[model samples]
Target chain A: MTVKELAEKMNLKIFCGETNLDRTIEGCYVSDLLSDVMGNAKSGMAWITLQTHQNVAAIASLKDLSCIILVKGFEPEEDTLQHAVEEEIPVLGTSQQTFETAGQVYQLIC
Target chain B: MVFEYPVQGGDFTNAGTVSSKVKKMMRQLGVDAGVIKRTIVALYEAEVNIVAHAYKGVITVQLDSDKIYIKLDDEGPGIPDINQAMQRGYSTASPEVREMGFGAGMGLPNIKANSDVLEVHSVVGKGTTVEITNNF
Candidate 1:
């Protein structure tokens, strides 16, 4: 599924990178740890996390993740949104907790 | 080609600036996506180390047809035990750093996993130097 499709299916909010919603999604990874995402997240995966910092965008870009999903209704910082726009990687949001959001994403992608 | 980028310690605001630039450079040079991915992962980890632990550091990158060599030399309190530091889940990052989702003790291991050749040398009172090589 594409990022837009996943967002629609999961009921996620697209805060930025609307231009990149067509990017393909191959998998899902849920983590707040930057290094863990860096070391393990695969290309084209949707990263579900509560990390709202700008560095999360860096990790998503570096690892080629498709999108970032902020759980628990957390909005990204201003810098984070800016980086998301710059990198053309979609920053998404959901009101559900990590486990629920991740499960939904997992079911959708897998 | 050779390039140098300086890193400031505790500069979380610009942690991945150097790596981002270098990644763009590598892409412009037509580096393979897989090789670039590995190289950037290793380089970014090293760059974050400078920001996390050192007072300051310089990242020197040398790119050639067959390989890319990166060296990071920092001035700060160095690692006393390279072996322990290499182990996963062993981090000395401040609480503030950890709160930012870094310093999980996986940085060096990730570097080692991604680089073709990884060399780390340090002196406790002086600083640390990390050299990473990734072949094209």
Candidate 2:
């Protein structure tokens, strides 16, 4: 699935990287733990997490993830947004709960 | 080939700035993508630990043709059990840190996975030192 589709599925607001919406995704990992996500997540996948921190962006950058979706309508911190912008990463926010968002993303990818 | 950064624990906002800079430098230097990815991942994990758990600290990076050496030292509450801390999913971070998507007990483990050599030394109630070397 592409990021644009995800935004539509979750009814989220995109804060950055609109040009890459057509980018294809292979898998999804739902975790608030930066380490496990970084250590195990496959590249070019969408990452769903409730935790909103700059470290999330750092991990996303290292892992080369396609995007970061903040579930449950949680807003990102200033640092998180700034890092995402600087890295040209696509960070999105959703009003759906973690479970629902994961299920939606799973259906799209799987 | 040598880079050093002062890691401030004052704000979680700046935790990954040092590692980010190092990552940019690697890109400019045209280092191998795989090597740069590994180094930055390990460096960022260590930097986050220092800021979240340490009172204050510094991150030093030493790079050469063969390896990248990163050293982090912080004057915060030290780890009491190195073995326990090394275990994956064994985190002692507070809920606040966990809310920030960290403290999943994967910092040290991730560092170990990304770097070839990792040595940790912590004096309980005093400070902690983490040294990691990534072979390119």
Candidate 2 lDDT over B1-136, as tens digits, reads 6777887774677777888788888777778888888887788889989888888898888878777788998899999999999998898898988776778888888889888899999999999999998877
Per-residue lDDT over A70-91 for candidate 1, one digit per residue giving the tens place of the 0 to 100 score: 9999999999899889999899
Give the C-alpha miss distance for residue A87 in model 2, angstroms.
Answer: 1.4
For candidate 2, lDDT tens digit of each residue in A3-103?
Answer: 88878876878977687777777788898777778778877888998888777776777677889999888887888888888776789888889999899
In CAPRI terms, model 1 is classed as high
Q: Whose TM-score is greatest here?
A: 1
The local distance difference test score of model 1 is 0.93
The runs of at least 3 residues in candidate 2 whose Cα sits more than 4 Å from the true structure, single-residue gaps closed, are A9-11
In candidate 1, what are the lDDT values of residues B16-101, reduced to their tens digit? 99999989999999999999999999999999999999999999999999899999999999999999999999999999999999
Give Cα distance to truth, residue A22, candidate 1, Å: 0.7
lDDT of 2 at B18: 84
Q: Top DockQ: which candidate number?
A: 1
DockQ (Cα-based) per candidate? 0.83, 0.64
